[model samples]
Target: MNNENIIDIIYGNLGSMTATDQKVAHAVLTAPKDAVNYTISELAKVAQVSEASISRFCKNLDLTGFHQLKIQLAKVADDESSYYDEINIDDVQQALTNIKNNKVAEISNTLASFTTPTLKKIMALINHARILQIAAEGNTYPVVADAIYRFNQIGILAIGAESWSTSIGQTLNLITDDVLMIISNSGESKALLKQIDVAHKQGMQVIAITNRKDSPIALKADQHLRTSVRQYVLNSDYYFSRVAAITAIETLFLLLIAENRKRLSAIQNHENIISTDKI
Candidate 1:
């Protein structure tokens, strides 16, 4: 195992790991190259475990600490997926083409994260949830509105909260059967964790859709749905998740409609009323 690639070594020991250790290992193995770059606190948060647990896991792997684990991971980084240093200063035409290509890849990768069984599980959760509180901020609120509209059409009770205050307010006021779906690309930021913690305290299940599985929001969710793998250089200040996260939300809405077609009778009813209002 010592001579093996760090990723491979982690995989090899998966069967033997304790549940807590496996959680940490799963977080790292989700994207070894990306995990390598994550700080100890970030990795711990993503793993939904303590930093001390991470240190113990490192020791179990014959490493001193998180730093040593990162050194090992770097040696086995996936260069094929790594384009951090290859900054694309694309001209107008190239930018258009490149952006389209990246968007296509983004949707494909986002869908790849879901399997048929997982889709069924998510749909079942939505069906059982008393209310779907879809939360997002800034530009992502449009995606939240879209999801809420689609869910309502299918007879699912949902509300879109575009502000953080509304997000936390739901936890204080909503019932346990409510599901809090948070869509954010605030990777590594602690801003949304407070909301997730509040939701948990209220006994609400959370569904988090984000660009990074290792993101704090993604890790803390009862159901963590991920979007396209984002690529950006270390310490890069600009990361917008609009397209990829939108694609993920749209995918889930379609799946819900497909799985719960019996609910579609409500869609026709909604259309009839909405048509009357328009005329």
Candidate 2:
């Protein structure tokens, strides 16, 4: 019952949340430690909402009551406060240990954030689409390319558009039967946002895989699959976001193959042909 899990739940549900609930969520996210200490009445006052709204918010997050939320928040506060307290960057062993721990935590958090119903919807869209296009830029481009490769290996028709103009051109031709899967860690890239706008206006459905569920691109897409994990280290020069995003993409690829025998057969056939040619 880590509050990080609760925080992820709040973010994952932000698209469908009421304004009041959003206020409560924001208040907690901004200062989880403080929130843990606040009575329901204090939190209500701080968030500028009624106590009933706070109770409803807890229930929405599947917590039985406000007390349970506080318990989770207290644990999270303790963990967060101590997460980096012992780290010594000059010590190689300590640095490597810290890095490994952070990566493991991030992957676990990303996995906990996934919703089965949303994943099923994404699988269904990919299965039924007349065409599947992936849009991404910068560091995210490789992930999109990998997804395209994986889909093609299973006999699924998929393409990747990495540049702004290419994405625009690809999205322009997309019809209602086509699906565009956009990968962006921040989900706020100017280029991707433009394409998302075009895709929506052109009557095409969009699926967004991003770290921030509340980001503009996620909000614009027809369905959003969120990746939980913030970038870490070295003045933001190092990023762990890709690890989580790629993990999600691979999970989808595996699930697609699992649910479709034809896809698996296609992959096996391709392998067999390659083996025979090599022989």
Against the hidden reference, what TM-scores do the models get? 0.64, 0.70
Give the per-residue lDDT of model 2 (tens digit) for 70-175.
9877766655522222245789898777767756655677777678999899999998888899988897788888889888888879987667687789888889
**Residue 231's C-alpha lDDT in candidate 1?**
38
List candidate 1 segments past 4 Å from native: 1-91, 187-189, 229-237, 277-279
Ten-residue stretch with the least lDDT total in model 2? 78-87
Per-residue lDDT over 1-279 for candidate 1, one digit per residue giving the tens place of the 0 to 100 score: 243345534543454568889889877865677787899999999999999999999988777788989988887576422222223555767756655665565566567666677667777778899998888777678888888888888888998667777667766787798888888765343656787888788898888887655556777888877665333333223346467777877787778777767767888999988897784
Give the candidate number with the greatest TM-score: 2
Candidate 1 lDDT at 16 equals 51
> In candidate 1, residue 191 scores what lDDT?
51
| Over 4 Å off, model 2 | 1-72, 75-89, 235-240, 273-279
